[model samples]
Target: MARHEDRDPLNEEDLAQIADLPKVELHLHHEGAAPPAFIRGLAKEKSVNLSGVFREDGSYAYRDFVHFLSVYEAATQVLQTPRDYARLTTALLEECAANGVIYCETFLSPDFCGGGDLGAWREYLHAIREAADAAERDLGVTLRGVVTCIRHFGPEKSRPAARCAAETAGDWIVGFGMGGDENRGELNQFLYAFDMAREAGLKLTTHAGEWRGPSEVRSAVEDLRVARIGHGVRAIEDLALVDLLAETGVVLEVCPGSNVTLGVYPNLAKHPIAELRDRGVKVTVSTDDPPFFHTNMRREYFNLANAFQWDADVLRELTRNAADAAFCDDDTREKILKRLET
Candidate 1:
């Protein structure tokens, strides 16, 4: 990563231009992106107690990554019905639009939606899609879903989640992925589920190299055959593996804020996103769970600008990278690309 002393600081005008630059984000977590206020409101309406999920200031509170998962799931408890998810879709998109995100693909776990039941997953999907469609029209921000399986839930549970993903594979639900506790299970253990998704024509991506080493990212590519790896920044530890990722065009959905907030790195200066991009790897910026990290797309651009001295042009290229890597169909991809150009 570039040092702060290496380049001139951005002025207010430069910062404003960078902030207004349209963005494309591909690694967002649907439930994880919920606004604290929205979650609290829903919890009240449902009469569900989410006492420890938030801090005194009302932000999601947790000590570590493992604890964050618990808090995230706890906040999700109030989103029990399809109607609740619909509201969530609108709320998150409004947040995205405010941050200048023109296109975003969020991870939606079937386990969270309906406990991996195929029939019930459809109801949740329909409700979310209806809300997404309305958001596109009203907010001008496109939303798509990537059905994810929770790794800690084990591979047997992944089977039903994969079934739900395969059943819903279409224009909106464009990909199948696994997220959660990358430390819990090996990537190969989920191969059967990944294979099922692939057979149904869903794109693949997996959470790897976040808590693990380069070997885990290698497994995600060689074993799961994913075209993208979520938080694959740790691949930087092995120069050879980094070269391989660049050569194979496996895009890294790098979330700098999430990494720093979760203590993956001490700070952005120690992060490897700039190095990975410099080495010819396809890298895109995103907020894995924005509010949890107290970040938004605009803030991501600003921090990267300050950390690496990135200007509007550099930020635009990163947004373009996300557009190219997105799981959306060709038509939607073109639309996003055209928006980026403007």
Candidate 2:
């Protein structure tokens, strides 16, 4: 391996130690999370123009934040129907199982599932639920979903997205969230959408503090009533916000590699996950878009261990933390905990 720069955060031996540990992933995106080979083949079958999305080696060619969106859309085009989503869900779970993921909560978009029609969204949801069931039975990995609206499309679109989420809230689709192009927008703009999901008894979480700063996390908690905040590490920059998150017991799903790869943090050592944890924040690990970020659950565990010198006990706490923060009911949570114990 080539010697890293002066800022190298981890040595090679550090990475090898944590690769075999079991883990739970809570912040992954469905489209952006696909394994590169799986996505490439899907595009090939559909003859989709994915040239700009992936290089010849099957790695995503993301230039920056803007180009990442275009590439994500291109990959998403192949998943046009229920079966496509079903297959994608199953495939993701299989990869997760191989990487020792016991449970995962994926973000699903109603925008792609016919853009808010309750009737069509049900079909799309059924496929995802069925795929989750199959993956659980076949691979012993449990999966759930969080229905989300593409925030860039404006909150007007979220009413339908929220409606679909409300009508279909159940065993697998246990939560609601928002993803896509939402770095600068205010959380109150989408309050109605969160209100609908809340009334449906669905748990809520939202992306915040990734591109923005600590104030973004405050807005999400204040307006959206989120139980968790995705990439909320920037809260570390603001003492009051950090205290609020810790006092209120809000979980932070921090993605170390994703933050580093996307320039959210200068480097892994500069990442605040460890600092947040030291300050009593409930933090867990995940890969937001595994293939796009060149990450997987095993790799995330390894990277975190390398960065923080976490041992097996710390990794186990991470999984238990995910279970506690999961939207599943008591029965499902028990089942997952049993697996984690063994």
Candidate 3:
């Protein structure tokens, strides 16, 4: 990690410039990014009770990581139809655009979309894509999906989700991944599902090493053979694994705010994102679940600048890293790179 004393501290103007830089976010959750007000309005219209889901001030509330999952699910209960998801895409993209995100790849779960049914998943996907298209035209932010299966749902459930991803593998749905409670299952258990997605030509990523240790990241790389690992900061605990990640050109979707909010690290200053980058690991910044963490792309950039004293050059490098790691096709990648240059 770059030490504070090793570089000149950024002034307020430099921080402002860093925050305004165009960003590419490779790790985001679809439902988890729902703004609290949107969810509240949906719940009101649907007559769903979301008593414990939000705090008095209207932010999502939870006692711990496990409880947060339950709260997240409760909040998502009202978004039952494809139309609801379309509205969500619009709201989320507006936020991303406000934060100067030019390109984003979000994790979309078949489980939440339609209970892992391919036919139903397709309906939900179409609605989302339509909204995404509008958002791209109106908000100047591009969106793509990575079909993700909840890890705690078990390997059997993941099969149907993977099948959905394979069936819909195309320009819009470009990747397949796993996200959920890391403690509940081993990475190797999802091997069959990953292989299925790979056969369909979808890129791969999996959440690992956030709650667990370096071995989990190793398993994600070796057993699952993922090109990216979400929140792989724990790999810093094992230097050899870190070196391996750098050598193999694997990307780490490091969500500093989420990690800090969830107590994965005490604070951003202590986070391993800079260290991972400095060690040659391909690290990128993102707000995994922005609303849940009370963060966005702008806040992430500003905090990282203060924590690491990273200037505009380093921040732009991270954006380039995210662009290189994005699962979009070449044409879209070229467009995003062009936007960044401006």
Which regions of candidate 3 are displaced past 4 Å? 1-4
Best by TM-score: 3
- Give model 1's TM-score versus the native structure: 0.97
Clash pairs detected, candidate 2: none
lDDT tens digits, residues 78-170, model 2?
888898888888888888999988889999888887767888888988888898898888998888889888878888998999998898888
Write down the lDDT that model 1 would get: 0.93
Rank by lDDT, highest first: 3, 1, 2
What lDDT would each prediction earn against the true structure?
0.93, 0.83, 0.94
Question: In terms of lDDT, which candidate is stronger, 2 or 3?
Answer: 3
Give a tens-digit lDDT track for model 3, residues 101-141: 99999999999999888999999999999999999999999
Candidate 3: worst-modelled 10 consecutive residues by lDDT:
1-10
The predicted structure with the larger TM-score, 1 or 3, is 3
Model 2 CA RMSD to the hidden true structure, in angstroms: 4.2
Error of 3 at 313 (Å): 0.4
What are the per-model numbers of colliding residue pairs? 0, 0, 0
TM-score of each: 0.97, 0.93, 0.98
**C-alpha RMSD of each candidate structure in angstroms:** 1.6, 4.2, 1.1
